[model samples]
Target: MTSTARILIVEDEPKLVELLTLYLEAAGYACHAVYDGNHVDEALTSFKPDLMLLDLMLPGKDGLTICKELRQHSQLPVIMVTAKVEEIDRLLGLELGADDYLCKPYSPREVVARVKAVLRRYQPQAPAAASTTSGVHIDETRFLAQLDGVTLDLTPVEFRLFALMTHSPGQVFSRDQLLTLIYDDHRIVTDRTVDSHIKNLRKKLEAVRPEQEVIRSIYGVGYKFEEGSV
Candidate 1:
């Protein structure tokens, strides 16, 4: 069984907050609840939660401001919760470095699932030798994949995709499999989503190293990483 993870619930709605706290505790997570945005700094300093479930609409300071402040100091995973379902709001949260977002009227179980997924991505792993033979070093500690001394600034999704593929070079993984690995709730995702993320990741990689195309797409199949290539 996985150990209990600490989570902070930063929502203003009392009833919803209680529901979330109860559900998270039942799911074997240690939870700390705060109702006002003004208390975020203090809670962050004291609670030191593994993940934060932040609501966009708060009483004092608004979620976006708090998110920006937190990102300046720490890369701690944050999942934004908002009553607004607009695409702009979602994009803004993602751009501000949120690991994930949950729209309001959501299931507590789904929230727990997302928290677990984000934790898995950000959690530290033991040191391992790089598989790349070209002196490329992959540092899981800093969430970086470097080749020939050039580092790639990958998003959370991109990093996870790269890590999984590099672990088993030359082995193909279907879109469904990759989706399940990256996201906890794969039931709602389509193959197109995976394709889009892969495209974006490739662009990021190409930005740093024009010649390196580690991830390869198989016609009518899926994607795989080249052997000995990081």
Candidate 2:
């Protein structure tokens, strides 16, 4: 885990924010707190948090709106906190790019655990050497991916997906196959989950190279890394 990772706590409840800060700080994470959604933008610019703990209901702006706006340009991890247990609310949070969420009346320790899980998914592990495939070079031991010598900020799932596809470029893989490869824990997930990750991965890659289509869709089949694109 990244000991220096900063966590921004955006909750109107002072007691809740205090509790969260205590737990996170004890876990070796830096914590910043904001009581209103209106201050989130300024806090983001000043604190430069690695993740955000956002509340659905806030004084100034709603968490959903903040999350939606944040996703426009940044992939900064966000874990939503809300009292609402509705399915639509959950789906909306996911659609707005929240990495995870905690329902109200949740344990503080559970919050810490969720934060750790999300960070683990994005934090790069130390890999000993780098391997080059096609135009992209991935250092598996270091958990790094580089496209045309530029680093790609891939989440763990994205890295695994890219690594698997690069292992045999041009080989088409079904969504089921990709899903199984990406997740070893056997967690229940839908095809849409796989598609969402793929979409995010494509966007991150395209940000660096707008013209290159590194990962190609196989129509009804699935997807494949374009060979010789490097």
Candidate 3:
């Protein structure tokens, strides 16, 4: 876990709030609690937390609305916390820009582990020195990526995927190979998860350079990055 990483908890339940705070604090995260969704904006400004644990149900404002509104201007890491385990709700939350989702009745340890996972993905430092090749530029120290001079608003997963593929062009990587490179934690994810993320990454890159196709799929095998494509 990243020591001193601040986590904002938005939940109306007092006991759950206390429990989450206690667990996160014990894991070296600074925790702040907000009972009402309406107060989230204010707390975000004041706390400037590294990540947000947003409860789907809240007084004054709902989590979906809060997340939707927050996505308008901020890319703050968000993990939706809720008792609603419906597939649609989970998909909606992801579409709304949530970094992760956790259902109620989950262990506090699991939450801590998840928190660590999200932060690790978002905060990974550059492995060697910063460099640029082709049309891509990356600053390891700053965790910055720029394509043809435009900075990409990539999610944690997107950023990791881009960095890994760009680091070694023309090398075919199976979905399993790419998954291991992307996530340090042992979280089980289907091949569709990797494909979905790749789709997103390709879209972002294409948005900046429509004529260039950087990643190519090797049917029945995996995918690879083409250095000369861009």
Name the lDDT value of residue 176 in candidate 2.
Answer: 90
Per-candidate total of colliding backbone pairs: 0, 4, 0
lDDT of 3 by residue, 1-230 (tens): 26899999999999998999999999999999999989999999999999999988899999989988997788788888878667434453255667777888899999999898888866755476554568788765565788888998776667777888888888899999877765556777668767877887888889998877778999999998888887
lDDT of 2 by residue, 19-121 (tens): 9999999999999999989999999999999999999899999998998898777878888887866643444325566766578988898888878877776
Best by TM-score: 3
Model 1, span 111-145: residue lDDT tens: 87887778877666787666564534667776667
Candidate 3: regions farther than 4 A off: 68-75, 86-95, 122-128
Candidate closest to the true structure, highest lDDT: 3
Error of 3 at 46 (Å): 1.9
Candidate 1: give the clashing pairs: none
Q: Which 10-residue window of candidate 2 scores lowest in summed lDDT?
A: 87-96
TM-score for all models, in order of appearance:
0.77, 0.61, 0.83
Ranked candidates (lDDT, high to low): 3, 2, 1
The whole-model lDDT of each prediction reads 0.78, 0.80, 0.82
lDDT (Cα, 0-100) at 36 in candidate 2:
89
